[model samples]
Target: MAEIKTLAATVRSGTGKGAARSVRREGNIPGVIYGGGEAPTPITLNYREINKLIYAGHFLTTIFELDIDGKKERAIPRDYQLDVVRDTPMHVDFLRLKAGSRIKVAVPVHFLNQDVAPGIKRGGTVNIVLHAVDMLVPADNIPEAITIDLSTLDFNDTVHIKSIELAPNCTPVDKSNFTIVTIAPPPGGAAEAKRAPGKLCSAQAAESRHMLSS
Candidate 1:
């Protein structure tokens, strides 16, 4: 489960671009909280504090306990907008969370035992098909990542979604079994590329997508 952090915010007096600009001038980021059967609440957060959180990674998936003028609410980040040129945060949106609520998130994938894989030792390339898998999980029970063991894999071996063991109660958003990664045969074999042999080609990626649709 992702860590829950406490952030302090103050209620904003009004809405619109003018109001947002005013908040920025005051060294704060404008934000809003909605959902969980409540009206949207406009707020502002310290620019520097929010900036660090955004760059620290996992800002979207990490739950937060927001302190709004002394009132607190539990929520997860739904979206955030950043400046195109400056890359500074412009606005953020939070979705209120209710007990037992399940939300869809893209959990990162991790591979294990790559050094000992027979295919890798034989010069096979590791072709990653999916960097992350979207899953529906309990608001408080989200796993940090999905781990796949590659120790037993050999050349031309493929890992599929159905072969993975997901955390309890975590369900993949996609129902069909799909390839996650493949151990591509070394150079001089079929489907060769100038890049690493295991590096995925467009054709392999297209085939995976086809499996999802089929």
Candidate 2:
């Protein structure tokens, strides 16, 4: 479930480029809240407050309780603009979330038990195809991340999306099964890159030829 973080914003009295600039000069990020059966609201938040959340990561997926003049609304960050030069947040757009609403979000995938994987202990490489999966999750039950177990995976074993276990009311948006991760054999596995009969480097190849000649 997504943690609801509380934030404060104030309704903007004026609207325009100059007004927005004034808001920023006052150390606040200008923004709006639309959707969820209500009229759009133009607002502003403290720069320090928004910057803290923006840099902490996962701001988009997490739900927020926006308090505007004592009225609280459930919201999710829909979009944001950043300063081209300073990389600071310039503006924001939040979408109101309603009860039982299913929202599509990209959830990060976490692989577990790499040390226990039989293939990994043998020097096999764990390749991740999809680091995150897009899914439709009940807004109230947004998961922090989806976990995949690799404890039993062996060399050359593939992980498909369909094999993954999802939380209740959460399902992948991708209709077809797709590759997520794989445990592959190490490079140059039991085979010579240049020669078929023996695995040899250039110097070793020369040594073999000299031995045959001798």
Candidate 3:
């Protein structure tokens, strides 16, 4: 397990949109830490420090040791506000965590052995129905990502949640039978060939019209 540590911040008094905008102009991100039976603590974090962590995709489940004015705290990212136009972070919300408590988080899923899957060799396409899964895990035992092996999957086969083997202390939130990935014939391979160029077949035409109607 890799431990991520970040410098703590001391917050001065500020309020409203104007103060937040000014903080951003100075290369700082306005944020707050809340949860765990304590009042929300307003704080500000360095923009550069946060950008690096966000860029590495480490905010989802990783714990950070935040050292604020010689005081230490543990936290996990809860929510983030973004500047939609510039695609930059505007603010962040961190939830203080306590040991032995289960936290709900979304964990990234990595597909392995895709190039060697039997379905891919047979002209099938892999469709990822779910890129990540919601799991309830102990805060200290969160996994970086869940890896799924697709080496033996055949066409029309699916990998479901129940089939996944999770690491210790990690449990998926969804029902056991949830489908995650499926191998299917490439779209419009044979169907497209059957339809006349500029005209759709009865089934295809009806489906298209229905889609437009909806």
Residue 195, candidate 1: alpha-carbon lDDT: 52
> Which candidate number maximizes TM-score?
2
Candidate 3 structure, TM-score to reference = 0.81
lDDT against the true structure, per candidate, is: 0.90, 0.88, 0.81
Cα deviation in Å at residue 164, candidate 3? 0.9
**Ranking of predictions according to TM-score:** 2, 1, 3
For every model shown, the clashing-pair count is 0, 0, 1
Q: What tens-digit string does per-residue lDDT give for candidate 1 at 1-214?
A: 7788999999998999999999999889999999988899999999999999999998888889999999989988989999999999999999888888898988889999988988887778899999999999898777888999999998889999999999999999999999999998887663342357567678988999999999
Candidates 1 and 2, the one with greater TM-score: 2
lDDT by residue (54-137, candidate 2, tens digit) is: 999999888999999899998989889999999999999998988888888999999999998988877788999998899998
Candidate 1 residues lying further than 4 Å off, grouped into runs, are 190-214
Which has the higher lDDT value, candidate number 1 or candidate number 3?
A: 1
Name the 10 consecutive residues with the lowest summed lDDT in model 2. 189-198
Q: What is the C-alpha RMSD of each candidate to the true structure, in Å?
A: 11.7, 4.0, 9.0
In candidate 3, what residue range of length 10 has the lowest lDDT sum? 188-197
